[model samples]
Target: MSKSIHKPGFVLGDALDIPTFKVLKQDGTLYKGAQEPEFDKEMALKLYDDLVFIRVLDERMVGAQRQGRIPFYLASLGEEAASVGSAGALKPQDMIFAQYREQGALRHRGFTVDQFMDQCFSNDRDLGKGRQMPIHYGSKALNYNTISSPLGTQIPQAAGYAYGQKLDGLDACTICYFGEGAASEGDFHAGLNMAAVLKCPTIFLCRNNGYAISTPSAEQFSGDGVASRGIGYGIATLRVDGNDLLAVYAATAAARAYALEHNAPVLIEAMSYRLGAHSTSDDPTGYRSKDEEAQWAKKDPILRYKHWLTQKDWWSDEQEKTLYAEHRANILAAMKAAEKRPVPTIDHLITDVYDEPTPHLRQQLKQLKAHMRKYPEQYPKTSGRLDA
Candidate 1:
């Protein structure tokens, strides 16, 4: 039998228009037809508290970077709900493959303020052992993968990890977080295709925050958005207002249920705006206007959630003030302690890769130590204890 060549009738203008799902309004009121998720007063208050804590942390850390206390930092300034809400919906056993800006997810998963400061300072107490740059976090206890600096690398990795989970007969999935800018990478396509083919339980969360560094979304792609691409790959997809906590939480909960029950992948494109500079290294004034930032500031997720909590009488203005004061003091103290700690030991440089250091690496380390000895005065006091 010969293969039949069939071309289905199709029209270019008949493409599907993906809708953005939203629940909470700018004033924190639910839309008339919007259904509230399974959130209760206690959960709502905790989410609100996390949102505020993350905001304060970002503000203080950015100031620290300005003061040269930290080398670099990335703030989730305008996109707290996207990270925290979605993370709140997931089970603790579920793993997270994060890009740098999802610190709120870690915080929601029990990462401490001291741990954040330790990683930022790259001190001996850091779990990553002074390896990663500031803001790149990881916690095995929390099942959050260590963040890599390369964009889109985690997409395919998430698929592979989920496949492993499936093989192990575990009821857990992996959530991969990236920016819209990362959707341009080849790994994005590869990851989605692999997940669809293997039926891996993975959620690809893309934060479509208007700009990729300084490049605007208008210049990034011509398609509807990242959410639309999921249709091409046969994956369940959703587009949500990233600033709306209730909407994000509801959508993520549904996505998790679908992925786990069907053993399939889902993609959530979070429509949001980065209300701060891309990082401490960049200046927002170069590409955005003050008026534009002020406009988004009006939709601040933390304040929006606060309004909802207050309306339910679960929160008060006095509580907000006290929470902010306590967080600020805790962060300041943590930063001071982290800064005073010692850097990773010199021998740690040759560890964690193998049971024994390779001859080439040992030789390199020896040469590095000789060079450091030759230039001891130039090195700082915290530069590793070579003898021990």
Candidate 2:
């Protein structure tokens, strides 16, 4: 007898029309029947403060980059709610693996303005020992993993880390932040599948800002979005208006609860648009029209949240003005201090990699120092300070 089998049919249709979860409207009013997150006044104020600080920091750093203070910079820009709002929903003990844009999350978790400046300037006080590029932030104490420049690499790493958390019986989960563009990589599939199969508690947060550098989302994928991909992998998923802070907080809080209770992974697709260039190196005007940007600017996340706070009697216009002035001065002072600090010593190049430097490594360092001496004038003032 011939071995015959019938293949099941799958239909390609809009069966899963994922709705965007939104609490706060563009006019800053809560939608009827939409419940607010369980956040107190103190937490609400802090979240709003983070949103403002990140915005001001981005504006200042971009100017700094143009002035040749920093080599490269990527701003969170219009996606502050997607970073700080979601971060605020989680406990500090939970691990965060970020794409370079989630600096607001770091700030929300106690990464100070001075610490940010130190890292950006690559000074001696920088946690990365001046090895990584500016904005590649990391903090073990805050449970935020060091950001790697390679895209989508953290997806698999987050799955593995969350699996270890599951085995260790820890009460925390891992949250991985990435762009919709990174979802195009194979690591995304591998990581989500691993988390699904292993039942790891990981929250995959995709900031779908409509562009992966210069490529638009339409050119990147034909699917509904990142949330649909999560459903395909048998993971719980959500799509939210990334500009609405309350919506992000509510969705993330619920997602975290489900992940921890069920020991499963979740995906959150934040639908927001980047209000600035992708980076200092990118000119978004070349690909996106100014009219399109102007349209999104009308839905500014910070303004929307500020309006909400004012409506709740938690903030006022005078307070906003005072806060902005104070933040600008503080940031300016921090940057100046960071610029004056020396860079890490040359010995830091090989110290963190291993417990002890091998013969070959020591030889390489010696060679590097001799080369630096030969080209002393070419090196920066900080680079010449071997004892730094």
TM-score of each: 0.96, 0.97
lDDT of 2 by residue, 1-388 (tens): 8466688656474569999999998777899999989989999999989999999999999999999999999998899999999999999889999999999999999999999999999988999999999899999999999999999999999999999999999999999999999999999999999999999999999999999999999999888988999999999999999999999999999999999999999999999999999999999999999999999999999999998998899999899999999999999999999999988888899987888998899999889888888888887774657654
- The lDDT of each candidate is 0.91, 0.94
User: 228 in model 2: Cα distance from truth in Å?
Assistant: 0.7
Error of 2 at 146 (Å): 0.4
Clashing pairs in 2: none
Task: Indicate which candidate wins on lDDT.
Answer: 2
Model 2 ranges with Cα > 4 A deviation: 1-10, 382-384
Q: For model 1, what is the alpha-carbon lDDT of residue 342? A: 90
- Worst lDDT window (10 residues) for model 2? 379-388
Clashing pairs in model 1? none
**Cα lDDT for residue 263, candidate 1:** 91
Number of the predicted model whose TM-score against the real structure is largest: 2
